[model samples]
Every structure is written in C-alpha cells, then in structure tokens.
Target: MHTIFGAGGAVADQLLPILLHSQQKVRLVSRTAKAIPGVESVAADATNYTQTLQAIKGSSVVYLLLGLPYDIRIWRAQWPVIMTNVINACKETGARLIFFDNVYMYGKVNGWMTEETAFNPCSKKGEVRAAIANQLLQEIKAGNLQAMIARCADFYGPIGFKTSVPNLLVIQNLIKGKKAQWLGSADQPHSITYVPDAARALYLLANKPEAFGQTWHLPTASELITGRQFAKEAAAVMQKPDGVSAIPGWMLSLIGLFNRPLKELKEMNYQSDSPYLFSSDKFNKAFGFTPTSYSDGIKETCLWAMESGK
Candidate 1:
C-alpha cells in the first residue's frame, strides 16, 4: 500500500486521484482523518514515534509531505522530532520513502538551480529545511534507506491560497476583485512550479526504483517570467484589471511587524528581490515530461477558482 503522511494539502489533494486511478491501495495519515473514498485514513501525530510507526506500518512506499505552521519556533521544535520519527518508522517498516521538499534550503541562487546546488541556507526556516533534508540524505548515502527528495520552487495551483505566494498575493486577490500584489521586485524573473505537475512527477519517481537515493527538481516550465508578467497574465485570465502593486521590502518588513505570516516571509525576500531561476532538465529528460505553461496554468487556475468558489 502507498502511504501519505500529510494528506489534506494541495499536492496531496492532487496526488490522491492519481494514486487511486493507478489502482494503488492508499493510506492517508494526518492529525485528523478526512473521509476519502477508496483510501484508508488514519489519525496520528508524526512527532510521536509510536503513533508515526503505527501509521506507517505495512506500507510499500511512504511519502513525507507534512507541512508545519509558518512559525519558526514551532518549526525548530517539531521538525527534527517529526523527521526522526518518520525516518525511524520508514526504516523499521521497510517502506521506500519519498520526501516532498522546497528550495528554501538553497537560499539565494545566482542562476538556474539544479539538484547539485549546494545548500547554504539564509533564513531560520531554510536552516530547518536543510537539516531535515540532510538527515534524509545522510541515511540515503549510508545505504540505510531507499529514498529520494523531490524539490520544487514556490508553487501555485487551484487550492493553495494559504501556501502559494502567487496564489495568495496575485491570483486570489484578482479573483476577489482586489488589486493584485507582488512581493519584492516585479521585474525580477521568477519560476513558480505548477502544483499538479509536481504531484505527477512525484508519482513517476516513486514507482521507479532507479530514481531512489537522489535529489530531483520536479518538472517546471523552462521559460521563466517576471512577477509583473505573472500578475498580468493571471489578471488577463480572470478578465480582471491588470493593475498590481509591488510591495517593497521595507514596507513588507514594517507590515510584518504585526502580521505573523508576513513576518515569517521577511527573511525570504531575497528570492523575490532578484532573479529566481529553477531548472528541472534532469527530471524532464529522465521522464520525458513537459510542464504546463504559465498561460495555460493561469487559465486553469482561474477556472478552478471560479468553479470551486475558492
């Protein structure tokens, strides 16, 4: 059976249908169970070793997709514990592991980032991410586990208003008839992953035994666009006004003094302030995958928002 540790987020929601269509027996584990047809739902806190072990038992492949809250204190306290619990559980259960990860561990990149890019974390959250990722990599390198890390850039999709920067600041704002906002520099080129593409890549990687013990940058469109271009295209797709205001770094830092989420984002402004290019040529060439373009992705995102009332 295929087991997912965190099952209610955007990627998990997208992954569920793919797993089911492939006729894979699926188990979903989270703090609270959500009733999903054709899948077994289990409630277990991953920070607790016993609970995590129970939830992951009897799984062929396990995905660690847990998303912690944005607070740094919570991340520092719980992330290591959770990683240890999950790692030990997967090891004992003999389940191959797939870890869904972000690019924060890379800090700022001068050009296109590949899987080989060194991890020099700039923020506290990035440090946390680097730690957990290293913990997994060390296990993989030591031949103690069969696993891989699937990493993605900032992503946006139908249902990730809270987690996706573009979805929250641009797409949803436009959908709600408000002026879209761009963080940092609107002129800097940015590469944002489409969530569905990420989910599809994960499924492909999980099924291939040779894909284990490596870091893969999930397939993202090769063509990069600036923040202004992204906002304009999203607005065009929604048939809304194309006016977006860029929130300067200083302004965001000031506002973050009161807003907890923005406060958490303050240190990561380096990403938006300059060109953030990501490359997925390894996965693209390996799997013959082509990612969805920005125009098509925005159109579908707009349609999904209107249809789902999100």
Candidate 2:
C-alpha cells in the first residue's frame, strides 16, 4: 500500500491518477477527505503522532507532501513538530518515506543548483526547510527510516490553480486578456518544473531502492527562460495581445503593508531579483526521463486554466 499525506494539494492531486492507473493500493490523508474514486481518503492531522500512525498503518511507502500556509510564524511553529510526528510514524510503521521538497533551502546561488549544492538558507522559511530536511537525513542515517527527497523548482502544470507564478500571474492574466504581472526581474532566467513530470519522477524514485537515502532533483526542462519570455509565450498560446510587466519590489512592499502573504514574500525577493537555475542532470542520467518543454507546458497550462475558469 502507498500512502500520501497532504493529498489535497496540487502535486498530490496530480500524482493520484498516476498511482491509480498502476493499480496500487493508495491512501490519501489530509485534514479533509478528497472525493476521488479508487482511492481511500483518510482525514488526519499529521502533526499528531497517534493520528499520523493510524493514517499510515499498513503502508509500504509514505509520501510527505504536506504544505503549510505562507506565514513565517506558522512555519516556525509547525514544521518541526509535523516533521517529527511524521518521521516517528514512518519509523514505527516501517514505511519508506518520499518527501516532496522545493529549492528554497539552497537560498541564493551563483549559476545552476544541483542536489550537491550546500544549504545556505537566507530567510526564516528557508531555515525551517533546511532544518527539517537535515533532520530527515539524520533519521535515515541513524537506520530508523529509509527515505528519499525529491526536490523541484517552482512548478506549473495542469490542475495547478493555486501555483504562485504561472497560475496567478501569467496564465490567469492571459486567459482574461489582461496584462500579465511578473515578479521582481522579468528578464532573469528561472527554472520551472512541470507538475506531471514531477509526479512521474517521484513514482519512479519510490520504486527504486537505489534512490533511497539520497536527494534527487526532479526532471525539469533543460532550457531556462525569463518570466517575460514565459508570459509572452503563454500569451501567444492563449491568443492574447497584452504583454507582461514586472511588479517592482517597492510596489510589493507597499502592498505587503496590509497583506500578510505579500509581506512574507519580501524576504524571498532575492530569488526573483537574480537568475535562479536548478539542474536535474543527475536525475536525467539515472532515469533517462526528459521533462516537457516550457512551450508545451505553457500551452497545456493555458488550456487547464481556461477550462477551470469556466
């Protein structure tokens, strides 16, 4: 049996069909049950050890795909506790763990980032991520659990309605025939991972024993594109005439004064202000999987956004 914790989010939502198609016995655990056919949905809070243990019982593999809100205070208070509970539950249940992670732990980097890059978290949220990731690794080393970390860049694909960049700014704006907003530097090259590709890669990694106890960057498209380029391509795909414009940091800060999420975003502005590239060469070499090109990804994303908007 394979169990997915925090299964209501975009990544888990994308992963569900893939697992179902394989005829795997899958359990989806979250605060509320999701109404998907051919899967068992269990409502449980992962921060509670007893509930997590009950949710993960009889599972061969457990996916840690939980996501917290964009508040630093909540992250600081909840991440470690949730991680500890999950780790303990996995250890007790003898379920192998696969953690879905992002690139925030690496902080700002010069040139492309790889799995081997050092952790130099710049913000409080980044520090929380780094700490939790390191704790997972320590547990693995201590022979308490078998696990792998599958990390991805900022992602956008089908069913990604709440994704940060593409959904909120690019695809939505283009679908509405409005000018797209770009965060920070619109010209800096940024890496993005297609959600479906990430789902496929995570499934593959879970089945491979050799991938255990290691961190792997998921397959991302090889070519890097700037936000302006992405928006332009998306606009063309959606047949919109409006162009993309950058949202200055000062403007974001002014908006942040009243909006908590926007205020929290200011600490991570360094990522958008400079070029951020993520490398998945190791994953490609191991699995021989190529990611969907940005053009194709954008086209599919636009279609999903248009359909969902209806």
Candidate 3:
C-alpha cells in the first residue's frame, strides 16, 4: 500500500480516484479524515513522529505533500521540524519517500529553468524549501532509503485556492464584475502546470524505481503564456469582459499591513512579472509523460467558477 500525507489538499483530492483506478492499495493520511472512495483515510499529523509512524506503517511508499502556514516566520520555524519528522518516520519504517515540491528552491533564474538548474534561492521561503529538499536528498545519498523529489510550477485546478491565481483574482473579480488585481507586469512569461499534471508526475516517480536519488521536474505544458494573455484567455473561457488587471508593488506592500496572504505573495512578485519558464523535457524523456493541454485546464476552471455558488 502507498501512504500519502496531506490528503485534504486539492492535489490529493484530485489524485485519489486516479490512484485507486490502478488498483493500488492506498492510505490517505491527514489531520482530518474524510470519506473518499477506493482509499482509506486516517487522521494523522506529519509533524508528530508517533502519529506519522502509525499512519505510515506497512506502507511501502510514502509521499510528503505537507505545507506550512502562510506566514514566512511561522514557516521558518515549522518546515525544518516537519522534515525531521518525515525523515525519522521513513527511517523507522524503511518506506520510500516521494516529496512534492515547487520551483522555489531555484529562486530567481534567468532564461528557462530545466532539470539541470541549480539552487540559488533569494527569498526566505525559497531558503526554507532548499533546506527541506536537501534533507531528503541527503537520505538518498547515504543509501538509508530511496527518495524522489518532484518540482512543479504554480498549478491550478478544481477546489484549488489560498494561492491559486484564478481563485485569488480571476473568478472572484469576474463574479463581481470588478477588475482583477495581480502582483506583477502582465506581459512577462509564466509557465503554469495543471494540477493533474503534478499528480501524474508524482505517480510516475513512485512507480518507477529508477527515479530514486534523483529529482524530476513535474509535467508542465510547453507554452509559456504571459499573465495578460492568461487573463484574456480566462475571459474568453468565462465569456466575461476584460476584468483582469495588475496591482503595483507599493500597493501590495501597503495592503500587506492588513492582509497576510498578499504580504507573503509580495516577496515573489518579481517572478510573476518576469519570465518564469519551467522546462519538462526531463520528465517527458524519462517517463514518456506529457502535460494536459492548458486551454482545457483553464476551461474547466472557468466552468467551476461560473457554477460555484460563491
């Protein structure tokens, strides 16, 4: 049986049926247990070693998909501790660990980022991510157990929120018929991953033994569409007038005094307004995996927004 942490999140929720379809025995562990078909849910916390050990027992492969609080200060205190718990749990159970990560470890890089990109993080959040990644990598390097890390770009899909572009601005603004505000220049290139793409890449990594001790870029669409272009496209999908727009850095900072989420998002505004292209050639060449079409992902998101009761 495969053990997964953070099953309450959107990615896990979407991945549940897909993993079960393969007839693989699955255990879904989170702090809260909810009913999902074909998978067993357990209420367990990753931060607690005793609870984690119980949740992960008898599972051959364990997936770390946990997240910290939105506050950077809180994250700095929590992420490393969480990683320590996960590492110890793996050591106790001898389970292979698969970590779901993001591009933060690479920080800000010029040109496109590929599998070969090195870590040179700038922001506080990026540094924390780097620490967590190295902890898991070290375990593999030591031959204590097997490990694989999957890095994905900012992805969106149904039930996604808190930091999702569509949930944060696109849909909410469109519903109110108010212009949406964003962090950076709309003209910069940004490659977005569909949530399904993220889940599938992790699945491939778990199934393939060769993936251990190596990092893999999750599947992302080939296109590097700009923020403004995405906005216009979303409008087309929603059949709404152009309601997307940009919010300057100073305003974000000013609003940050009252809004913690926007404040946390402000540090990385440079990437949103600059080119943040992620290359997936490594994953495609390795697992023959290609990402879902971007238009289809966006179309579904728009439909979710339209039908949502608010």
Candidate 4:
C-alpha cells in the first residue's frame, strides 16, 4: 500500500479517484481527517517527526506531496521540518519516496528544461526546494533509502483550486463572463501540465525499480501558447464576455513588491515572459508515457470549471 500525503489538496483529489479505480490500497494523510471511500485516511502533521514516522511506517511507497502555504515566510518556517521528517521516516522504514515537485529548481533556464537541467535556483522558494531535493538525492546516493522525483509545470485539474496559474487567474474571468487575465508575456512559449497527467506520471513511477535514484519531468501537453493565445483559447472555451486585457509583467512586478507571493513570481518572469519549453523525449522513450493533448485537457478543465460553479 502507498501513503499519499496532502490528500486533501487539489492534486490528491484528482489522483485518488483514479487510484481507487486501479484497485491499489492507499492511505490518505492530511491535516484534516476525512474519509475517502475504499481508502484509509490518517490525519497527521507532516512536520511533526513522530506523526510522520507513524504515518509512514509499513508503507512501501510514500508520496511526498506536501505543499507550503502561499505565504513565502511560512515556507521558510516549514520546509526544513518537513524534509527532515521525510528523510528520517524513509531511513527508519526503508520505504521509497516519490517527491511531487515543480520546475522552480531549474531557475532561469533559457530553453526546454529536461531532467538534466542544472539546479541554479534564483528565488527563495527555489533555493529551499533545491536544498531539500538535493538532500533527498544525497540520502538516496548514500544508500540510506530509495527515492524518485517528478517535476511538473503549470497545472490545472477538475476540482480546481488555487494551485495553478490559470486556475488562480483565468477561472474567475471565465466565470464572471469577463476577459481572462494572463500574467506575463503571452508571446513567450509556455508548457502547462494537466494535473491528472502529473499524478499519473508519479503513480507510474512508483513501482519501477529503474525509476529510483533519479528525477523525471512529468510528460506535459506541449502548447506554444503565448499568454495571449492561451487567454484566447481559454476565453473561447468559456465563451466569456469580450474586452480582455493583458496584465503586463511590470504591473505584476510592481504589485509583487507589496505582496510577497507576487514578488516571488517576479523572478519567474523569465519563465512567464520568455520562450521556455520542457522536453519529455527521455521519459517517453523510457516509459512510453504520452501526455494528454492540451486542447483536450483544456476542454475538460473548462467543462469542469463551468460545472463547479466557479
């Protein structure tokens, strides 16, 4: 059985239904104790060593799906505790860990970032991520435990919440019958990973012995959508009211100075404003995993957002 942390979060919500259908026994852990039909639920603090160790014991694989709150300051307070606990838990139980991660560690990369991208984190959060990930990799290399990493790009899913860039900004516009807002230079090429595909990629890697001790980029639908084109497609999907305006990067950066979260996004202007892509050729050749098309995924997300009354 596998233990999925952050079970109440968006990614887990998207994953559980599919995972349950696969007939794999799962233990869901969250800050709040809630029941998922046909799955065990455990409420525990991820940063609490004893709680984490207790929850992790006897589980063959653990999904390190924990995410920090939106507050940058809180991340500083929390990530170390969580990583220390995770490392200790893995060491004690000899369980393999699959870390759910983002592309932040490959900070300021100029082209399609692959699994081989160097860790040159530029943001505070990126540094924390690099530290934790490298520490995990070191532990694995030391033969203390087994580990794998899956890095994803922007994401959207059915039970859409505040996790993805589009869901955070675009859904309101679609729902409000207004033109959606795009945060950066739309002309910059962007790759958005559907949340289901990200979850699937993580799950597929769980039992693959060859997958251990390395990192893999989640296969994502490749779309060369500039922020403008993406906004156009999203607007079409919702058929929203016209008069959409592009929110410029300078404005976002200006607002970032007052808002810590927005400020964190300033460093990522390179990604949101530049020609960035992700190459999944290696993963495809290795695992034969093909990502769902962006159009299909976007259409599904549209129907879901519209249905959710968001």
**Predicted structure with the largest TM-score when compared to the true one:** 1
Q: After superposing candidate 2, which stretches have Cα over 4 Å from the reference?
A: none
Which runs in model 4 stand beyond 4 Å of their true positions? 241-244, 253-260
TM-score of each: 0.98, 0.98, 0.95, 0.94
Task: Put down candidate 4 lDDT per residue, 227-310, tens digits, no spaces.
Answer: 666666677788875334666778878898788777777666767767778876677778887888867777788888888888
Where's the lowest-lDDT run of ten residues in candidate 3? 159-168
Question: lDDT by residue for model 1 over 149-229, one digit each (tens)?
Answer: 999998988866978889989988887889999999999999989999999999999999999999999988889798889
Ranking by TM-score: 1, 2, 3, 4
lDDT of the structure predicted as candidate 4 = 0.80
Candidate 1 wrong stretches, greater than 4 Å:
none
Question: Which regions of candidate 3 fall more than 4 Å away from where they truly are?
Answer: none
Where does candidate 1 clash, by residue pair?
A: none
The lDDT-based order of candidates, best leading, equals 1, 2, 3, 4
Say what the RMSD of model 4 is: 1.8
Instruction: Report RMSD (Å) for each prediction in the order shown.
Output: 0.9, 1.0, 1.6, 1.8
* lDDT for each candidate structure: 0.92, 0.89, 0.81, 0.80
